[model samples]
Target chain A: MTAPDDTLLLIEDLTVSYGAVEAVRGIDLTVRRGEIVTLLGANGAGKSSTLNAIVGLAPRKARRMEFSGSDLQGVPPETVVRRGLTLVPEGRRVFSSLTVDENLMLGGAKHATRGDPAAVKADMLERFPILAERLHQNAGSLSGGEQQMLAIARALMSSPDLLLLDEPSLGLAPQVVDQIFDLIGSLRERGLTILLVEQNVAQSLEIADRGYVLANGRIELQGSAEELRASPEIQDAYLGA
Target chain B: MDIFLQQLLNALSLGGTYALLALGLAVVFSIIGLINFAHGELMTVTGYAICFALIWGLPFPLAVIAGLSVAMVAAFLMERVAFRPVRGASGTTLLLTSFAVSAILRVLFQNLISARPIPVSIPASLSGVLTVGPLHLGMIQLISIIVTLVMLLGLNLFLHRTMAGRAMRAAAEDFAVLRLMGLRANSVVATAFVISGLLAGVAGLLWVAQRGSVDPLMGALPVLKAFIAAIIGGLGSLSGAVAGGFLLGFIEVILQAYLPESLLPYRDAFAILVVIAVLLFRPQGLLARKTLVKL
Candidate 1:
């Protein structure tokens, strides 16, 4: 599908390599404004690399990589974040020593061009009551699901226009996974665009407006969620039909 | 009782100096995993700055300000010139870089300034004794204790209260994650160095006041002691550094007070023994938090 003018992130012929190995080999992707786009792939399929490359975490080369109509190539990771693209890195790399409140505070510490940090923190606390209950407790003390929530809440604290979630449901309990997916859906409803990378194929497909299937560091397929869900190739490979 | 009170005050004051220097070391180490052996040189820099300021006819307070300012600027330059180029290299490389910087600065001071210890005269009031009830307190000791506590309190508030400080704390845990939070790595690491420099300034002043002289190698013994204190308290942990410093001070002063005069010459040996015993028992230092692996 042609990218609409409202596209928030645009990537064309993007390549990510670490030394001799290429993780993402020349793939084009787009995330339009206010849409949930899931980039789904199996292990070693360059899913994480794609997300990392977007934020300048990985060595990347691209013909065009734009976020909010601005070139993202060569921008430092921190500057990319200030440009309103925040990543909840794989494994929810929260400052475990810091208390929940401190994590949220650090998240909003550089809330570039956003509302008052105090207000953003209050909004996060209100949305994630569990985080509020354990505001003073170290983030390490939290369970996997709770830490994930705190990680997402912390990302939201930045008030980013585009939120990149990398395997938010990884290592979470099944019920907790449901809660995270629900949270992602709710965030989209609140007008925050998300580019999700997940291994949970079925659930991601359910919530994603469009889906891209990556294989061996390249896009193998791309279509609407409904069409991909109905496709024989998806059902045979992933849906267990 | 009076003797005990005197020793207690001495311990507090001495411990305060160690705490200040150790916390300085810990601050830099925690954020970037660099065991900056040159941290002692920062003290040396401050001491020389103060000495030069005095020689140049500046008032004591103004000299102190000049000393601290030079130390801060020196620290900034140290990072930008030496450390930044070798950043992200192995820990050993960073440690070696610090040693090289230390040696270079010391040689420069020895050749250009004076190889001999430069005596810095202070007001008589700073050297006088204070009588509080039945106890006598050395002026230097009292000031050291007070300044150490105040600096600790200020640092504590900065870490817990300010965004920059919180960013430092976070960077200590996960640097990449800190960048993802929209804070620059250069700024955070630079801030750590500047804070450490300020701490070294306070600590160097105290050390110089007690000695009445500043030498090129004056920082050597105190910084070594501070390093041991930081390790005993848990190297990267700030509170641990303070606790370790105080503990080391108490051990040294108590040893001096209680040991036979003949054994006093070997006091540091006994202190080392105590540190060895503590490490044998805890291994992780007294206050290091176990890093939990995320599943």
Candidate 2:
């Protein structure tokens, strides 16, 4: 359902490097509005770096980085969140010391001054019943899937317009992965823009309106999810036999 | 019996001092995860500022305000320039920089002091005396204990009730995640240090008033006590630091009162032994989560 001209993210000559080692090499990519755009790639293919750079985590040289009409090249990560961009970083970095409710409260911080935080929390608890049951428990005690839900819920607390997910299915059981991906589908259905960096290329592409296969810090192929799924290049890249 | 009551009162007063210092240190360290060696010097600087103001014939209240403001501002600047850039560097680097700043500040303070201990005079109304049966005490200790309690309560409320305080706590948990909450990590850290400096400022004024003398090395004992208390309590728990402070104070005072006269000078040594035992036995203090963090 994404129009070709409705761009949500624009990266022009975005070259990110750490000292002599470049991570994202002047990759120009555009994510259209209101769609699940998956960046599928191998571990060292620079997909994570590209996402990190967009979120202001990478220390690099960017010629231009802008999201949804705002300049983001020099902006810090906090400002990126305020401008409606949230990244569920790799490894599910939940605040292990804080309680589940506390984590949700922290996630809802950006929205605090904007409206009623209590209401947002109640709503999030409604959406994730597992979180509601464990609201008072420390996040570290939760199972891996529950932690991922907590992370996503916390990021959602800020009420971000665009959600960037990095490997949400990294270490979860197959059944739990389905639940997480299901949550993603639900989130997307509610009109949340998502730029996902996922390892499960088949499923990610299945849900993705468009997909980009990145290899060695550059985009190897880009097309509709169906087109990319049917291509031999993607099959060779992801499912090498 | 009379002397016992007197020693208990003295112990409580001492506890108040340590609690304030440790609380400030714990709050700042929790946010940034570095032992700010310069924290003691920040206290010394505030004490000198108050002393300097009193020498200039400023009113006692105004002088204290000026001193507290100056200390908070200095700590705020230290964060923006020095700590922010090297925040993610090795802990050793931050420790060295903080120690260097501490030494430099101490030298600067020593230069400003005359040969004599200047009288940090307060208003007559503020320095009233009170008697309880056989124990005679000045109003300053009572005022300090009350103020410390109020500040601790205020801090608790701030941490629990306010949005900014949640940001500060979240920043302590994970800076990257807090950033996703739309908080600038540096600003959050600055706020914490500024509050710490404010605590140092109040503690400094109380210290010089209680002793009625301002020495260049006055900060050493208090800072040392704070570090010990922090280690004995959990390093990250504010309430634990306060409890450790009171406990340290009571231990020191009880030993000073009950120990044989010949061992009087070593009373401080006894309190330190307790600190060491606590550290050896319960290395994580009383409140930290027992998680194995990867270095």
Candidate 3:
């Protein structure tokens, strides 16, 4: 475990619930700066709930939740984005009705008050050339892989210090998934801290510096990526080895 | 032929007013997914303001401005006070809340002022008719059409070019995602109400000009027609509302013009029958696109 001082994001005793149903229960985790941390889980393991809670999308309570030393209690989702934490939501919730360019522009809207949105947009277009090619086209017209790319590019337009990605590889073809994982690896190389929630355990572990397995609203396992890959339980449950 | 042209112009002018009212309702509906039935009360409130302004010896333009301002303020208050509390409630609940609000406003107007019609003097310039070549047109009709056109153009530019306008459109798509872009929920919803109010105010002015009087219940029929227009256009589409309004206006005018004198009294009933027929054919409405509600 990283020291508390070095931790960029720290969550202590966090819980999330929807009405009477508890989705996440008393989880503690930390992501130090510039690390790709993966949360591995099954469909109902509360992975999405954890990410949603951090960004204020889900009902949550925590003993201590801080990002870069700033307390995150009662902060709204927009403020969370403004504070340099951006989430690429599940199923690539790209604004399908809007043009590709408009989606990118909206992504940069949060930073528009503080920085040059035009510059950020230009950078995103350069980074995701496919988005540039289809700038005038509606986002819905894009193929699944392309839409996924647009979703990531849109989040990057905010220039967030930390990126929370939920199921980036949910329904993509194998080759497209490989491309997305490579993109994730490259983003890490650029020093963006990432909290990745994924079902593709093997690929996530390959890029993740650390991994946590969640089951039934609790963290079942936590270790470095190599240790997780070698574990017999992980092999049996996720890898099918 | 000249009489036919005159009737067409008249129909177009009436259509313009209905279009404005429908557009207002559609704007509010698109953003919050609430069919704000009290939208008509905005017209009622504006009509009262105009009457009071004229009573105070204010000039016609100033009276119109007063009416517009009052309607805008009322719209903002409606959202902040009545609608905001019940936001995210069931569709039936929202509809009932707006209906209750409409009833309250009507009652307030009746008790505070007069239940009877209050005569409003139209400026002579507006009341006059203009004849050019073979065509004749009422100045008020011309002004109403022109104003509606200008307002529509302005609204189009705002929605297409401005950031706030884009945010409003995005809110229709997924309001939560819009918040993730760092927009304040209050500001976006408030903006929708403001626009709705402005449209209602202008429509009210035209409506009063045509009727030559204002009463506590003056907004009821026009608002109902506007609701029909919005439904015909597609509940959540702005352009559809305008199109639907114009279509409804044309249908009413045509029925009134062409129907025998004996059948003139049943024109409104016939118009509703036509709307019902159209709905039977296109249940989702004329321009109904599939809009996915986000989870």
Every candidate's lDDT: 0.91, 0.81, 0.89
* DockQ metric for all predictions: 0.56, 0.39, 0.39
RMSD of 2: 4.0
Query: Could you tell which candidate, 1 or 3, scores higher by lDDT?
Result: 1
TM-score, chain B, predicted structure 2: 0.91
Sort by TM-score, best first: what order? Answer: 3, 1, 2
lDDT, ranked from best to worst: 1, 3, 2
* Per-prediction interface RMSD in Å: 1.9, 4.1, 4.2
The residue pairs that clash in candidate 1, if any, are none
Worst 10 residues of 1 chain B by lDDT: B286-295
RMSD of candidate 3 to the truth, in angstroms, is 2.7
CAPRI band of model 2? acceptable
DockQ winner: 1
Better of 2 and 3 by TM-score: 3
Model 3 Cα lDDT, one tens digit per residue, A1-241? 3346778899998999988999999999899999999999899999999999998888899999999989888998888888888889898877777888888888888542346788888877888898899999888788888888988988887788899999999989999999999999999999999999999999999999998999999999999999999999999999999
In model 1, the fraction of reference contacts reproduced equals 0.60
Off by over 4 Å in 2: A1-4, A12-28, A42-46, A96-102, A110-126, A129-143, A213-223, A227-241, B1-9, B52-59, B112-116, B123-138, B263-270, B289-295
Error of 3 at A10 (Å): 2.3
